[model samples]
Target: MYKAHFGLREQPFGITPDTSFFFACPSYQEALNTLLIAVRNGEGFIKITGEVGVGKTLLCRKFMTTLGDEFVTAYIPNPFLEPRALMFALADELEVSLEKDVDQHQLLKSINHRLLVLARAGKRVVLCLDEAQAMPLDTLEALRLLTNLETEKRKLLQIVMFGQPELNHKLQQEAIRQLNQRITFHYHLGPLNKDDMEFYVSHRLSIAGYTGGRLFGSSAIQAMYASSGGVPRLVNILSHKALMLAYGEGKHEITARHVRAAARDTGAARNKIWFLGWLAAAALITVGTSIGWAYFK
Candidate 1:
């Protein structure tokens, strides 16, 4: 709705994990590198954990796209299935055809055979599971069993799990110790820093065809960082709302007022009392600076 007003080709702050809008912040890049290196080395189990809306899924998608022909990847976006169902899902992803009446043993055999065949062909197999925290204990064990299918030289199948922080708690359970011990590489994705947030906002705007002058002022960006705690998804939500508020008032540039309004509307604006105190201090400093300048002149 504010695209035309802002001279942007499209909405700049959409919540979707569109790779085109991906901002390669330092933390994100490190996570990506960790995942890539782990996968390339054929690590048996790699785990990536992050807070909600911290771009784990986006990183997972980007990782998948970056894998070349040397590797075959299977992604399970939802891993809440039972052990048997989970095996069957992996089988489906690998295109291992099985009879309708096949049991768990038959399914495991089929999957193992496919993994061995791929291994023999010099292609590495990686299974990426998202939302792995919701997976049942038995299902997790089943996944661990899959990793056991290995040749004498190396593992036949590797697994990369991307999930929320709760996934760590799940892995810490006594029943899942075996799987936990198998994870050789792990990374915890964190929120962006102040610099990264600024770059991220500008990058998104630039990608959306913004050619106008600066839209968000320094104070506004600081306000956003304070309100969003440097989380990309929260930044997107606040920035989009701030733009809409600016457009609604027929303004060209976003100000602290717009950011405050956006933050208030989104309920992400914490420390209101402290914010007011800071505003007062800033106003006093501005007045003092003006007086000192006038006196010197």
Candidate 2:
């Protein structure tokens, strides 16, 4: 609705994990590089943990896109199935055909054969599981056992897990200690800093076809950083709402007032009294400066 108003071709702050909107901040870039290196090295098990809305899914998608034709990738976005179902899903992703009468052992054999074929063909096979923290304990163990299918030189199928912080806790369980020991690489995604947040917002907006100069002023950006705590998803939500507020007011640039209004409306402004007080102070200073400039001129 506000695209035309803001001269943007599309919504800049959608919550979807769009790789095109990815901002390669220092932390995110490092995480990507680590994943690439770990996967390329045939690391048997890799884990990336991040808080909710910290761009974990985006990073995961970016990794998949970058791997491209170099690797055969199976992405399991939801891994909450039972052990057998999980294996079936992986088999389906790998294009391992199984008849309706096929049982779990038959499915595993098919998958293992496919992995060995891919390995012999000099192709790296990667299984990326998202939301892995929700996976049942037995399912996780089943996955670890699958990693045992390896050649003398390297593991046949590399596994990459992206999940919330709870995934780490789950891995610490005594029953899953074997899987934990196999994790050759691990990274914890942190929130973006204030500067990164500013760049991230501007980058997404520019990609969405915003050619005009800064639409969100410094104060608004600061407010956004505070409100969102530098979390990408929260930043998207607040920035989108702020843009809508600005468009509704027929304003070309988003001011602190618009940000505050959006924050209040979204119930994200934690320090409401402080934010309103600053707004009042800024308004007074603007009015006073305007009067003095007019009188002097």
lDDT of each: 0.91, 0.92
Error of 2 at 114 (Å): 0.9
Q: Weakest 10 consecutive residues, lDDT, candidate 1? A: 265-274
User: What is the Å distance of residue 171 in model 1 from its true position?
Assistant: 1.3
> Per-residue alpha-carbon lDDT of model 2 for 1-297, expressed as tens digits?
999988999999999999999899999999999999999888999999999999999999999999957699999999999999999899989999888989878889999999989887889999999999999999999999999998889989999999999999999999999999999999999999999999999999999999998898999999888778899988998999888888888989988788777777775465766788899999999999999999999
Q: TM-score of the candidate numbered 2?
A: 0.89
Give all TM-scores, in the order shown. 0.88, 0.89
| lDDT, model 2 | 0.92
Candidate 1 ranges with C-alpha deviation above 4 Å: 267-297
